[model samples]
Target: MKKHNFYAGPSILSEYTIKNTADAVLNFAGTGLSLLEVSHRGKEFVAVNDEARALVKELLDVPETHEVIFLGGGASLQFYMIPFNLMKKKASYLDTGTWASNAIKEAKFVGEVDVVASSADKNYTYIPKNYTIAPDSEYFHITTNNTIYGTELHKIPEVNIPLVADMSSDIFSFPVDFSKYNAVYAGAQKNLAPAGVTIIIVRKDALGHVDRPLPTMLDYRTHIKKDSMFNTPPVLPIFSALQTLKWYKEQGGIKVLQKKNQEKAAVLYDEIDRNKLFRGTVAVEDRSLMNVCFVMNDEYKELEDKFADFAKAAGMIGIKGHRSVGGFRASLYNAMPIESVKALVQTMQEFEKKH
Candidate 1:
């Protein structure tokens, strides 16, 4: 049976990337040494690190004023690091989903945090539109995409305050106005590479502005000064991320990926809208292209378990939704092929017929 992956994080990667990474794990660049065996400080590894950072800049069109650092710790660490480094007076946050709320919690520990807008009352099923931004706040924070609740901010609102985004789930899935953000961080597991590494792109001018003391590793400047080698980095994930970025560049970067991702989401969403057994969980305008969430109709709710079982039997995996909202979630990242989406739609159609 052919397998299709729809896992959310640590999700599917390009077959080309997987094969090349596997080959490198055995023997990297004909050095007869596995990528795992190489010293991070070696010239070869340094080249890998440098190219990875460069490709990130190219892929995202990050400005010269921005510094891209690939460091350990997931995007979770940045929830605190951003406040510790940037929040001197107060910061504003949009409570879109779990990750955004967590970021707000971390910021409150460092300084005052104002929740400018939130969708919690609606179970984060939609993005809040009408909100006021305080000019005096250090910066406004947002989660670009809500992974658990399958909602996305399609267009970032313009605010006088600098914007900080946690783009862990949707980074590089679409084109972003890099100039509009003061800092952006993402865990590599979703659209970039694998777990064990996080990418931090911060505007250089935003640093050194906070009065709070920071540990050496928590400070972005420390990593920037050492060229992201402040400590031995995650070499394998960085190398794989480099390969993925190279692949992305060859595939025409975010512009091309955005079109493909939209089409992928549309395939499933169209099926959801047309099918009688399923309905979308999020507001149509706020639905995420990365995570397509849906639930069974009231009459078919009793068959939820059966639907999941059938999907599994048909070679579909990870179609289960988040526990916070019960239903089904199909995480279609950049590397997920169009054929996989088609297969999922076919499974949904088949299940609908049976029910």
Candidate 2:
């Protein structure tokens, strides 16, 4: 049997997507050409690109004004590209955690960055509120979910300027009003596909407005005009993303997935609250549905290693917390089955009983 997967990124993918991608690797769509050998510009692969792009728009209900394009670099590149393209003089950023702070770091290279708010004071355990966005700032940036800290922004900030968001870890896992964001970028590893592709959705009108001339490749208009084919795309991962998108539609879209995700997070969170040995780390109101983090109780901290070994021996995988935050992190991505979550809960209970 396969072990339960709880790693943060390059994480779990739907078994259905995996099987189809494997079949494509053997012979894509019965074209007698392996997916690996096929030209990205070929008709068969072009269809793959078209369908994946369409599915993203359909899944997100993105408006006609927004152009969805797949790019080579992960969200890290977008962290810089966003500011490079949009920030002429100044920008605003919300500091949430590791990724968010890195995004802030990138924006600093392009222009003056005004940190609107930050949760660093509390070790990023909670989302900061009551921060003011600078009216003169070119755009406001936010990371919707702090994967490392297990905190999420339940609400989107309303502002007159463009609202750019990095939804790398939470996109498609929950329902979002796509229009509220002038631009959105997400790496496929978390809830979409493998690590090769990053999805970028930007309002068409929002581009070509910055004063600085962006490089041809970094320009959003270039990818949009070429239909994300300025260069060879990560065909296999895009195909895999299409399969995942198909599975998502068959499963009744994001609204339905949101309910299922909530249920899955509830199960583990409830267990974390009930179990005598473990307790959640993030604030109750800001806990992430995608990455549920918990730590051993203060009195039982010595047993953390033992419990980790116990879970590992019981077929659990990738539950180790990050270096900065020492605890267990169970990443419940979109493709993670409810049964797997239950298995983790059961393991936690069984370990608690033994302790």
Candidate 3:
């Protein structure tokens, strides 16, 4: 049976990315050495690092003022790094879900953090609205997409102070106004490459403002100054990312990918709404294009496990939700085709009939 991939992180990757990466693992850049064993300082791997950064800037339309760098720690490390390097005295954050709340928790250790707004009152099913960021705040932070809670900030908030966002799950899913943000960072697992590297787009001018001294590895300036080669980079994932970027450009870039993502999300979301057995978790307006989360209707709740088993038999993989928000989560990332979404919907319908 052919399986449909829906894992939230370390999610599905394009065949183009997978095949090319597999080839490189055996013989990287025409060098006989496996990608896993290649020297980071060698010209072959260095070219991979350079092109990956270049592609990130090109695809995102990142401004000249910003520098793109790939780092070793996952986006979780960024939770502390943002506060360490950017927050001078205080920072403002919007709390929408688990990750956003985690980011807020990390920032508090640095200094004062005013939670401008939060949807935690309702278990993060909706995005908070009508929030105000303090003008005197050092910077405003937001998690643009909540994978676990299945909500997204469809519009970027206009703020006076510098703007920073954790765009881990939705960075390449759509076209963004790169000029508006001082910094944006993402983990490579979701929509880009694999699980080893995190890509950061930081405006050059935003650094060197904080009074506290930063550790060498923790500082963004150190990596930016060295072109992300200050230390040995994640060689394999970086190569895979470059291949993914090339595939993205070949598919007509972000705008084209955005339309495809929207259509895929709509298919599953419509089934969740129309089918008698299931319903969506997040507010309709804030539904995520990357991760479509839903659950069985209240009366049919007992059949959740049965439906999961049936879907498994039907060749579905990784449709189970997070433990904290257990139900069903189909992560429809950039590489997921609409056909797979239709298959999941069919599985849901077949299960409803059986029940």
Best by lDDT: 1
What stretches of model 1 exceed 4 Å from their correct place?
none
lDDT string for model 2 (184-251, tens) is 99999999998899999998887787888788999999999999999988989899999999999999
Model 1 residue 8 CA deviation in Å? 0.6
Q: How far is candidate 3 from the true structure (C-alpha RMSD, Å)?
A: 0.9
The better-scoring model by lDDT among 1 and 2 is: 1
| Backbone clashes in model 3, listed as residue pairs | none
- Superposed model 2: Cα runs more than 4 Å off: none
- For residue 210, model 3's alpha carbon misses the true position, in angstroms, by 0.8
TM per candidate comes to 0.99, 0.98, 0.99
